[model samples]
Target: MTAVTAPEPAEQAKEGEGSLRSSAMRGGIYLVVRQGLNVFLKLIGVMLITRVLGPTEYGAYVAAFNVYLYSTLIGQAGVGVYLLRHPGEVPDLAVRTCYALLALLGIGLMLGLEASRGLLTGWTGVPGYGPVMAVMALALPFKLITIPPTIALERALNYKRVATIEIGGDTAYYFVAVPLALTGTGAMSLAVSLVLRELLFFVLAHYYVGHGPRFGFDGRTAKSVIRYAGTFSFANWVWQARMLVNPLIVGPVAGQHAVGIVGMTVGILEMLSIIKTIAWRLSVSVLGRVQSDFEKIRRAVTEGMELQIIAVGSLLLGFAWFGGIAVPLVFGARWAPVMQLYPYVALAYLAIAAFNIHSAVMSVIDRNTDLGLCYVVHILLLGLGTWLGVRHFGMIGYGFGEMLALLAYGLVHWALARRIGSPDYRLAGLWFVAAALGLFWRQLGWWTIPLPFLALATPASVRRIRRILEQIRKPRRAEARA
Candidate 1:
C-alpha cells in the first residue's frame, strides 16, 4: 500500500508524531501480552522437560535443536523481511514466489543436513541428532505456512494477528510438549513435540491470513521476491552467524552441559527480545510505507528507535538486577546456575537494542550488503575471541566475548550513522551506558523504574500514555443529527 505523502514538513511532523506513536504503542502492547504468555509457557515447558528428562537429556535436546536452528538461518530466509521494508509492485504476488523459493531452499537444506548426519552427531555429541536434524529440515517448507503470511500482516500493521498466532501457537507447544515430556518419552519427545507444534501453527495461520501455502509456484512472482530475497539472504546470514557463534563454539569446547546453560540463558535473554522483534517488524512495515518521503521516514525511524531503546533497555536492566535472585526462586533450584550467566549475556541484548536503529536504517535504504560485510568482521572477531575465551576462560569468557561482539555491532551502526550525518547518541549512548551499568552495577534499572516518571514523560513524549489508554478503552461516540 502506498503511503499518502504529507502536505508539508510541519503538518507531516504532527501527523507522523501521532501515527507512529499509535502504531508502536499498539504493537508493543500486543507483544507484551503475547510475551507474557510465551514466558509462562516456556517456564512450564522447561520445567517439565528438564525435570522429567533431567539435565543431561535436556542438554542433548537443546544442543540438537540449535544445530537445526543455526542451519535454517544459514539459508538466509531474510528476503521476506526485506520485502516488508521495501515493498514493490504487487504484495500478494511478491509473497507468493517468496514462499515457493523458500520451499525449494528448505528441501536443499534438509538433504544437506541428512547427507552429513553421522559427522554432525560426532561433532555435537548429542547422539541421534541426525534424526532431529531430519525433523528440523521440515521447518523450511512447513514454515511457508506462517512466515510469509505474518510478514504481509505486519506490513499491514496487523500485529494483533501476530500476537494471536504467537500466543496461541506457544500455548499449543506448551500443552502438547509438556504432556509428552511428562509421559517419559525423553529427548525425542521434545523434538517430535516441536515439529508437531509447527505443523499445528501452519494449519492455524490459515484462519487469520486466508489460504495457506499454495502448491503452485508462480515464476514471475518468484523472480520478483528473489531480488529482495538475495538482499535478505545476506542480511540474514550475518544475523544467523552471530546467533550460532555461541552454540558452535560452546558445544565443541565447553561440553553438553555448558551448551544447555547457554541455551537456557538465551531463552531468558529472549524475554525482552520477543517484544523488540514485534516492534522491529512493525517499524519495518511502517517505514516501508514512508521511505520515499524522507522527512516521514526519518521521523519514524528516530522516534521508533528511541522508544525501543528506552523500552528494551529498561526491561533488560530490570531483569539483570533481579534475575540473580529471581530465577532460582521462580523456576526451581536447578536453574540457579543459569542465573549467574544471564547478567553478562544481557549485554548482547543491549547492543542489539542500540544498533537496531542502524539496522532499521539499512533495511529502509536497501543496503543489505553492508550487513553481510559487518558479519564477516564480527565473525572473525567472534571466532578468535571465542577460541581463546572458551579455551583458557569459561562461561565468563564466552559471555564477555559476546558482549564485546554485540558492542562492536552497535559501533558499526554508529559509524554508518555518522557517515549519513544523522548520528544518534540517544540510541547508541543510552544503550551503551545501560549495558555497561547492567554488566557492572544495578543502577541502570532506574531508567525503567519510576512508574510515576513514565506517567509524567508520556505527557511530553506526545499524548500521555494514560490518555492513549483511555482512547482505547472508551466507546465510540454516535454521530449528531444532521
Candidate 2:
C-alpha cells in the first residue's frame, strides 16, 4: 500500500467547514419543519386553553410553567452545551456525569416543590399553582435524561430523529392538554400535559438511541464539563431569567391577572420568536463543530443573522399589521392588552434578530466571559426596566421597558459580533428601520405606511424563499443537467 499524508491545515479546515455548513443546512431544513409543527401545535394549544381557562386560570398556568421552565435549566446544569462542545471526549463519561448531576437536581426540585407548594402559591398569588407546579416538577428528571441523546443527535446532525421526537412530544402535550382544559382542569391541564410530554419524549428518545439508561461515575469528566460550562452556562441562565423579569415583577405588583396579561403578550412574542429560535438552534452545533475555522464561523454568523432578520422582519411586520384586530378576535376582547403589548415585544424581537447567532459565535470563539458579562448586563437592564416600567406606566410601561432592555442587549452584542463576524451593518440597519416603521404604522394606526414597508421587504423575502427552494431542488437539478 502506498503511504498516505495528512492534508494541509488550510485545506483540512476548508473541508471541515464545508462539512459543517452542509450538515447545518440539512439539519436546519428538518429543524424548520419540526419547529413549524411544534409552533402550530403550541399555538393551537394556547388558543384552546386561553379560550377555555380565561385570564386568572391561564395566569396560574403561566406562573407554574415559568417555574417548570427555569427548573429544567437548573436540572440540566449546562450539560447539553457541554456535550455539544466536546462531542468526542469520552462520550460515556460525559453522559454519566450529566445523568448524575441532572438526577440530583431533578430529585431536589421535585421534593422542594412538593414541600413548598403552599408557600409558592402564597408567594405567586396564583391560588392553585402550588400543587400544579409540584406535579409539573416531576417532569424535570425525565427532561434531563433526554438531553444526552438530544445532544448526541444534534452533534451527529441527525435532526430527522430530533424532529420526530419533538413532533411527538408536542403532539402528546396538545392532545392531553386541550382535552383536559376543555374538561375544566384549569392550571392542572398545563401541569399534567407537561409531564406527559416529557415522559413521551424520554421514552421515544431512549427508544431511538436503542439503549437503556446507564449509571456510572466520572469525577474527572464532571469537573471538566462543569468547568467548561461555567461562564456560558451562567450567561444562559441569566438570559433565561430575563424572560422571567416581567412576570415576576408584574405578578407581585399587578396581581395574577396582570401576570396573565403578560403571559398572553409573551405568547405573541414567542410566536414572533420562532425565526430566532430556529436560527440559533441550528447554528450553535455547526459553529461548535467548525470553531477552529474563523472564516467559517464568520460566514455562519453573518449568513445566519441575515436569514433571521429577513424572516423575523417579515413575520413581525405582518403581525404588527394585523395584531390589534387579530388578538381580540382570536383570543377574545379580554386579551386586548396583548395587542398593545405586542408592538413593543415585536420591536424587541427585531433587534434580537440582528444578533441571533452572536451568542453561539461567542461560545465557539471561547468568549464565554464576554457572553456571561453580556447576560449580566441584560438581566440588570431588564429587571430594572421592568420594575420601573411597571411601577410607573403599568403593563404598557412594562412593554416599553422590555423593548428598551432588549434593544440595548441586542445592540451591545451586535457590536461585539461585528468585530468578529464582519457582517453587513447596512442590511441590519434596513431591517431595523423596516421593523421600526411597522411599529410606527401599528402604533399610529397608519396602515398604509406599513404596506410600503412590506413592499420593500417583499423582494428580499422572496429571494430567501427561492434560495430555500433551490436548496431543495439542487440534487434534482443536477440530475436534470446531467
Instruction: Point to the candidate with the largest TM-score.
Output: 2
Per-residue lDDT of 1-482 in model 1, one digit per residue for the tens? 21211134464467564555565567667777878888778877777677666555666777767767776675536756655654343345555566667777777876786787788678766565666666556665565436666665665556688878877777877777778888877777777777777776677666676765744466766665667667767776766666565556776788766777777788777876665676666566556556666555555555555555666767776776677787766655666777667767776676676566567666766767776677667776776777678788775566766755664575466545544545445433544554456554543455544442333354344453454456544322211121
lDDT of 2 by residue, 173-237 (tens): 99999999999888898899999999999988777777756656689877886787687677778
* Off by more than 4 A, model 2: 1-19, 87-89, 414-422, 445-448, 451-482
**Which candidate leads the pack in lDDT?**
2
Shift of residue 260 alpha carbon in model 1, Å: 0.3
Where model 1 places Cα greater than 4 Å from the true spot, the runs are: 1-24, 86-93, 217-220, 293-302, 426-431, 442-482
lDDT at 446 for candidate 2? 72
Angstrom error at residue 30, model 1: 2.5
Worst 10 residues of 1 by lDDT: 473-482
Backbone Cα, N, C clashes tallied per candidate: 0, 0
TM-score of each: 0.82, 0.89
- For candidate 1, give the lDDT of residue 164: 86
In terms of lDDT, model 2 sits at 0.73
